[model samples]
Target: MSEKDQEVKDQELEEEVAELKDLEEQESVTDELTELTTKIDELDDQLLRARAEIANITNRNRNERELLQRYRSQDLAKKLLPAIDNLERAMATEVTDDQGMNLKKGVEMTLASLQQALKEEGIEEIPAAGETFDPNFHQGVQTVEASDDVPANTIVQVLQKGYKLHDRVLRPSMVVVAQ
Candidate 1:
């Protein structure tokens, strides 16, 4: 071959190599772009999951707080009910002297006022006197000999009253029951 033809062939080979290199670089750029897009999609999915988890936790906490608020007064109300009962019993006593009667009447009024206040606050006495003795509501203190009128396990007297907090018995009534 002539030198001129050989030079032309060399130039043609160099041009082909350059074109191939450029195509390789373009393919690498495309691959990099695809990898970056995949990473972005993963991050978006993670962010969505995180937000949903936080929302679920927040809602759970709010529900717990509401439940606490609704039942928080139960313990306090149970503690205050006994004093109210004592006051009511004191006021109902019979007095012979004028001074004693006046004092009894005053005490009775105070007890009635306390009971009314307790009613307003959802505090109430359990009815136990002369009822059938129940271990769930009343604690039998002493067994009295049953007369013909009263059956065995009948509540002869309530020594101390029982109380309820809503539907639950807070304190069982202390009673003397018929044998």
Candidate 2:
């Protein structure tokens, strides 16, 4: 072939590739469109795969951002524990019916407000009463002999409460169980 014919063929091939790329994007190239479109569909399949890969990467990045946002407060809250411990100790010792009804009322109100604040942040006490025993949620410190009504391996008493954050265990409840 003449050099001019070769140049024309190259231009035609380039145009064909560009057309295929466009068809692939619209997903309109198929066996029914034409034989050339069938080959375009093969290229389209690869294009589809590449697009899907990019979409997956975008979704993964979004998920990571959401997870970071969710756990952002964990570090700050860890630092505040000692003050909370002191407050609880003081509250426990200060409780009395002799401090006058107003003092008792004030303390109860303070405790309720504190609990409400924690609840808003997704901190909740693990259920301990009248539920089936679970080693995962409960730390069994002791086992007591059981009667027929309670059943063997059932929870009898809760020594301390546990907590969860978004389906993850922050702590396990300490309990006594029937065995």
Give the least accurate 10-residue stretch of model 2, judged by summed lDDT: 76-85
List per-candidate RMSD values in Å.
5.0, 12.8
lDDT of 2 by residue, 1-179 (tens): 99999999999999999999988866754545687877898999999999999999999999999888776655544444444445565566654576656665766677677667667766667798677788889999999988989888888898777766556566778899998
Candidate 1: tens digits of C-alpha lDDT, residues 6-92: 999999999999999999999999999999999999999999999999999999999999767655566877777667767766766
Candidate 1 to truth, TM? 0.58
Report lDDT per candidate.
0.83, 0.75
Q: List where candidate 1 sits over 4 angstroms from the true fold.
A: 1-35, 126-159, 174-179
Q: What's the residue-level lDDT of 15 in candidate 2?
A: 100
